[model samples]
Target chain A: MKASEISVGQTFEKVVVEDLKRTQLVMYSGASGDYNPLHTDDLYCKEAAGYPGVFAHGMLTMGMTGTLVTDLFGAENVRKYGVRFTNQVWPGDTLTATATVQDIRDEDGRPVAEIGIETVNQDGKTVVLGSATGLLED
Target chain B: MSDEKTVTFPVEGTHVMMFARSIGDYNPAYHDPGKGEGNPVGAQVAPPTFPQAVAQFDPEYPLRIKDGEAWFGSGGSPSGIEGKPATSGGLHAEQHFEYTRPVRPGDVLTARYSQGETWEKESRRAGKLTFTERLVDYYDQDGNHVCRARGVGVRTERPVDQG
Candidate 1:
C-alpha cells in the first residue's frame, strides 16, 4: 500500500477462515511441520490430553490472522509482525481478522505504516492481538 | 540460558505454496513466480511467518514424531508415552518476527537458535505459568541476515480451564 493512499484510522478486514476444519489443521501441521498432537490427534486430545478435541495450532491461527496484514501491506512490505495468542481456536469456529492503520510516520527516513491487528472468533472473543510495521511505497 | 542449535532451511517454491495454502493465503507471489511480475519485492517471497517452519529442519525438535521413538501422542492408546503431563509440550504465548529482507525461493537459510528469557506468572485459568523465550536468527547462503524470530512459550501447572 502507498503512503499517500492510506491514512491513520483506516481499517481493512477479512473473514480469514469460515468454519475452520480439522483437515486444515492437519494440512497446517503437515506443511508447517508442527506435528503437535494437540492439534491433529483427536484421540489424544480427548482420552489422553482431556481437551474437547483437536484444536488449531497457535502458529496456524497467527498465520491465518496475518493474511489481513499481508493483504494490506504486501508480504514483502512488512518489516515487523508480532502477535500474542489470547485464546484457543477450535474446529467449526469462524475467524475474522482486522488490521487498522494506527500511524503513518517515517522510520530511518523511510515511510512506514504502523498498524494494529486483531483476530476474533465467531463469538467475538479475540484469539490473537498484534501489531506490524509496513514500509510504504515511495 | 543460550545454547547453540542450528537448522538449515532450504526455501523452495512448492513449500512456500503449500504453506500459503495452509494459511488460506493465495497470493501469487507465494505460488507462481511467473504470475508475480508485479510483486513489489521483484520476486516471489515467503510469508512473514515462514521462518517458523525451521522447526521442520531441527533434528531435535520435540514436537515432531521420530521413528522408533516413544511418541507423546496416541496411536491405539491415548498416549504412547506414560506418565507424561497432558500439557507437557506447553503452548505458544507470543511470536515476533523482524525482517531485514524478504526470503525468496532458492535461498538456503542457516538459522541459529538460543534461549532468551524466563519468567513466571499466576493465572486463574492456567494456574502457575512459566514462560520461556527463544530467539532465532536466519542468514542466507551469502551470510546476510535475513530475519530474526522471537517466540514465547508457556507451560501451565495444569490443563487450562476452559472457563
Candidate 2:
C-alpha cells in the first residue's frame, strides 16, 4: 500500500516464522562475522556460559521486521528504522512481526509515513519493539 | 574506542548475497545483478540491514577476527573489583537504522564508527545498568552519506544471564 493511502492504526499482514533452528543461528554467525559464543556455541550457551541453547541475533529479528517494511514501501523508500530488543529468541521458538501505520504527513514538502513495529514469540511475549519512517511514493 | 573509527571496503555482491541468505531474504533484486539492468537503482542492491553485517569488513572492529569462544572469553569484568568470570556484556538494549540511499555492489563505502552518549539506569536484571550507544555512518567514495546505524550496548557491574 502506498504511504498516502495508509491510515493510522492500519496493521499490515503478519510475517511469521516457526521453530527457528540452530543452523539458522550458524548461518547468521557466518554472514555477520559475529561469532559471539552466546550466539553460536550451543555448548557454551547451554552448559558452559549458562543459557538454554543458541539464540538468534538481535539484528536478525530487527531485520525480519525491516523486510516487512521494505515490502510495503519498497526497500529504497525506508528513511529510518529503529528497534529495541526486549526478549531473547531461542531455537524452536516461533515469531510473528506486525507493522502498523501510525502517522502519514508532509515533512519539508515531502510526504512521509511513520510506522510502529513489533515482533512477538509463540508465547505472545513481545521480543522486539520500535518505530520506522519511510518515504511515501506518490 | 577512538572518537572516530573509520574503515573502508568495497561492497561486493558475494557479501551482499550471503547476508541476504543468512537472513532468509530471498529477494531477487539482491541476488541477480542483472535484475537491475534498465532498473532505476542499478547495481545489485544489498538488504537494508546489510550495513550491520558490514562490521565484519572492518579489520579494526573491537571484536573482529575473534572466534565466538574467544570473544566471550575476553569479555573483561566490568567491575574494577575483580574475581569474576571476566564476562562483561550486559545486554543489547536497542538499535536503529537510517538510510539516505540504497547501497549498491561496488560502492567503496567508508564506515565511520563512533561512540555516542552513555547513560545509566536501575534494572531488575542488571541492577545498575549502563547503556553505551554506538553510531556507524556509511558514506560512498564521493562522501555522500548512504546509511547510519545507531546501536546501544549495555554493561553492568554484575552479570545477567538471558536464560
Candidate 3:
C-alpha cells in the first residue's frame, strides 16, 4: 500500500522474535564485510570481550528494524530511515520492532509522513531507535 | 600501545547516495528525486547502513600489527586472512548505531571512528582469524549529535601451523 493511505500515529505489526539469531548476524557480516569478533566468537567474546556470550552485530539488528519499516510503508515509499543502538543484543535475544507515525509534512507542498521506528528486546529494553520520513503518493 | 585513532568526515548527500547504491538498496527515498516529499532539496534519505559507506579509517591501519599480536594482527598471514570477499574485500560483520535525530538534506554530517577492540581465534571453517572493531560517531551541521555506529571486521588467514 502507498504511504499516503496510512494515517498518522499508526503502529505496525511486530515481527516474531524467533527471526533474531547468530546466523542472521553471520549473513549480514558477510554481506556487509564487518567481521567483528564480538558478534561471532563465543569464547573470545565471553573471555576477553566481556560479554555473557556472543552478541549480534548492531547493524544486523538495525537491518531488522529497516526490514520492519519497509514491510509496513512499502520499500518504495520510505524516504528516510535511521537508527541508534542503545544496548547489545546477544544471541537468542527476543526482539520486536514497532513504528509510529510522528508527523506528516509537505516539501514544496508535497505530502510526506515522518515515522519513528524502534526495536525492543524481550526485557523491554530498547535496542534500536530511529525516525523515518516518506512522501505519500499523490 | 596507544588506542587506535579515529577520524570523522562531514556527511554529503552524494556520499550517502553512493552508500545506498553500493548496498543495492534502491528505495525511492534513496534514489528518486520527486518520489518522496517532492523536494529535490537534497540527496535521497540515507539507508540504514549508509553511515558505514564512508572510509572512516585508513585502509592500511588494520594491517599494522605484530606477529602473534594477540588481538588484531596475529590470526595468520601478514596480508591478513580471507573468507568471503567483501564488496571491496571487507565484510560488515556487525554494526551498532544510535541516531539522536534524523539526518536531512542541507544537514552537514560528520563521522568520527576509533578502533574499539580486537582479538584472534580459531574457526573450524575459516581457520585462524583476526578481528577488529571500529566505533563511529555522526554529527549534523549544527554539531548536534546525529548517530553513532560501531562495526566489527574479521580477517582470516592460514594458520602458521599449516605453513
Candidate 4:
C-alpha cells in the first residue's frame, strides 16, 4: 500500500466516541511507570488543580490516532507519526479523526507522503492536530 | 510544585534498543547498526514507542486513587485504591506522542516526567471514571531538544465497566 496508490484527500470512516472514561489512568500509570499526581489525585485534580475532573491522557488520544493511521496505511508502511495536544479530551466526549494529504516528498530521495490529521470531539473541538509521514512501499 | 526536584538519566543505544524490544517493536532502524538500502541511515534508530521507557521522578506525582484521597496500593486492580478495595478491573484507554527528532544510536537521551492533569467523571456501571496524563520530555547528548511524549490511562471503579 503506497500513499501514491490512495487518492489524495482520502478520509477514513470516522470513529464515534464510544465508552469514553477516565479509568485507564491507573493502568497506564502502572504500565508506563508514570505517577504524576496531576493525573490521578482527585482532590488535587479538583480543588487544587482546578480541572473539570480527571481528564484523559493526551498520549491516549494520540495512540488512538495512530490506530487510525495503522488501519488506513498498515503499521509497517508508517514512517513517522506525531500529534500536538490542542484541547483536552474528557470521558464521554465523542471524537472524530480526519486526515488530508499534505504533500509527497522524497526523504533522502525516497518517496514519502505527508498527511495532516485533526481529531475533534463531538463538540467540534479539535483535541489533537498534527502531521504524519509514511514511506510508500512498492 | 513548580520548584519540585527532578531526576534525570542519560539514555544510551542499549537502553533505547531494549525499550523497543520490550514493546515488541523490531524495526531494523532500531536493531541494525549498518547503513544501506534496508538500513536507511546505517545506524539503528529507536522505535517510536521507545521513548516511554525513560524514567523520571516528581515529588508531587499524582497517586492513582481507588477512592477519595487514598492511592491505589495493590499491584493490580481488583484490590483497592489507596485503601478502599476496587470493584472492577482496569483497561488501557488511550495514548498520544509527539516526536521532534528520531532517536538514533549513540545519541545520548535524557528524559523527565511530571504529573500534568487529572479528571473524574461518571460511568453508568463503574460509578466513576478517572483519567490521568503524564508528560515526558526527551533531550539529546548535546542538550538539543529531542521529543516530548505523553501517555493517558483510564481507571474504572467496577470490573464489568471496563473500557
Q: Which candidate is the best by DockQ?
A: 1
Residue-wise lDDT of candidate 4 within A37-126, one digit each (tens)?
Answer: 444555544443334455665655665555555445444446667776666667677677887777777786777777888899887888
Best by lDDT: 1
**Positional deviation of residue B41's Cα in model 3 after best superposition, in angstroms:** 21
lDDT comparing candidate 4 with the true structure: 0.57
Query: Candidate 2 on B1-163: residue-level lDDT in tens?
Result: 5748788888888888888778777777677865632234655787788888776887655544445423443234322223435343456789999899888888999988888999988877656778899999999999999999999988765546554
lDDT of 2 at B24: 70
Model 4 residue B145 distance off true place after TM-score fit, in angstroms: 13
Model 4 chain A worst lDDT run, 10 consecutive residues: A43-52
Q: Model 3 RMSD to the real structure?
A: 11.1
Ranked by lDDT from best down, the candidates are 1, 2, 3, 4
- Interface DockQ per candidate: 0.77, 0.49, 0.08, 0.10
TM-score for chain B considered on its own, for each of the candidates:
0.95, 0.77, 0.60, 0.65
Which clashing pairs does model 1 show?
none
Rank the candidate models, highest TM-score first. Answer: 1, 2, 3, 4
Ordered from best to worst DockQ, the candidate numbers read 1, 2, 4, 3
Lowest-sum lDDT 10-residue window in model 3 chain A:
A43-52
In angstroms, how far off is A4's CA in candidate 4?
A: 4.1
Off by over 4 Å in 2: B34-43, B64-90, B157-163
On residues A1-138, what C-alpha lDDT tens digit does candidate 2 reach at each position? 455577889998565567888887778878887766667666555444445666788887777667787777766677889999988888888888889989999876778889999999999999999989887766
Worst 10 residues of 2 chain A by lDDT: A42-51
The residue-by-residue lDDT of candidate 3 on A27-80, one tens digit each, is: 554544455655565554444433455567566667667756655555445556
